[model samples]
Target chain A: MNLKIEKVAIDGVLVRMPYNPAFCADEDKTLLHGGVLTALLDSVFGLANFVAIDGISSMATLDLRVDYLRPAKSRADVMVRAECIRQTRHIAFNSGRIWFDEPDQAEVARGAASFALTRGEVSIFDAMTQSRSSK
Target chain B: MTPDLATQQLRKVPFFQFLDFTITELAETHAAATMPFAERLIGNPIMEYYHGGIIASFMEAVAAISVSHGPDLQPPKPINLTVDYLRPAVKGALMAEATVTRKGKRMASVRTACWQDDDSRPVAEGLYHFLLV
Candidate 1:
């Protein structure tokens, strides 16, 4: 997924991913696979968690739920907004929605998830950067 | 339909092709598939763990086949899905089996479980709903 962060606020995050025909379900390449939307939501939720919570380390998705409100039929870019709704020492809850970048912007899917937090010395961001630099 | 025939059908789907899985079993109310670990499927680069979404997608693909599979099959429309992650999917092939819990004229429910090695130790379990209409 070629994702771009469009907005990041304390309450939520917005991301955009261009539509790819490789992710289509039909031979005609008109309709997208529902799993693509689910994957997008999951990724966006992780980003939201990373942005909202000042965590020291990594997190894992405990569960995920996604509802496809409509057939993901469009060549337009996909947009997703996600937020960490609540967070405790060991857990975080997230909610989000997906839509097209076109006008009317009908919601294609809605998702919610919970993550198991692992707070430690190094944040995932730092760890990732350090790993890349070391590599 | 035979598993080989089902796999041939899956090749037509771009998303399924991306997943690169094989239909290992097929029956009236059951479907199973196996997906080998690939770098593209990794969610945590440091740990090289399978992405949660990829696991869910693989399971959903098998679940869909369980509900409908044949030539000129009008694939069921997905309404919703819920996935529970039980364990970390490491760098290895993952297997998923889908069982159709209920099938009606207009709807169907499929339960899917995914595992890496031991069948008893599932990495994830999911429930999916589809609209036949």
Candidate 2:
């Protein structure tokens, strides 16, 4: 199972996927493992900021809301599309969609998220400045 | 919606801090350490594939990450996590990507998706909302 970063479009954004049998979590339903999904979503979003953000920065996902739209039926191929929709001085925003095939579009899910981008080191604010940081 | 201490407290749990616990990284910056796919992590009833519930947990984790990405904002505890199983995840290393769609004083909304072997077809999709306590 070699899952490499496939595409990193404009603005340093990164995209990738896994192609193997271990990516599966369940064998009966042919459904994917939850951890795998988490990995995919996390990678793309992290890459999104890694592309745009400057300096040695860090972010904590305060909230992650997900709504599953439909079931992915394909067994051979799967895809996830993500893009940065907005970026503020303090935070970076992005959105993404998943599809199994074309025409049908057959959307598997849609997501929108926010990540806090900051300069300086992580411990400085987490350790020293308590209320000075801007989110 | 600001989350209560309980929600914020979930981040302190060590069980939530494993590499396989990819979503846990959403609790804080710095990508997850490892991708642990233990046998117990496998899903049931899905047959030959993985279960969507496990995937849902990961989605929930990402949603948590999106809501709590900001340093100024304390990561919101998951008040509601709804997931729609799109398809079976591939049997291998899988990854997910998510970003904030909207953030308010009391609520945060985000989106995420699961990619398997093929970055073209998503194994699952999710829309998440966090209630600020």
Local accuracy by lDDT, each model: 0.93, 0.52
Q: Please compute the TM-score of chain B alone for each predicted structure, in the order given.
A: 0.99, 0.68
DockQ of 1: 0.85
| Predicted structure 2: lDDT | 0.52
The segments of candidate 1 whose C-alpha lies over 4 angstroms from its true place after superposition are A129-135
lDDT of 1: 0.93
Please, what are the lDDT tens digits per residue for candidate 1 over residues A32-115? 999999888888898898888885498889999999999999989999999999999999999999999999999999999999
Candidate 1 lDDT tens digits, B1-133: 8999999989999999999999999999999999988999988887889989999999999999999998988999999999999999999999999999999999999999999889999999999999999
- Give the clashing residue pairs of candidate 1, or none: none
Q: Write the per-residue lDDT of candidate 2 for residues B1-133, one digit (tens) a residue.
A: 1223323444443224432444334433222212345554443212334444456666666566556654355545444454445556545666776667787888877777766666578776667666666
Q: Specify the CAPRI tier of model 1.
A: high
True contacts kept of each: 0.78, 0.14
CA RMSD for every model?
Answer: 1.2, 17.3
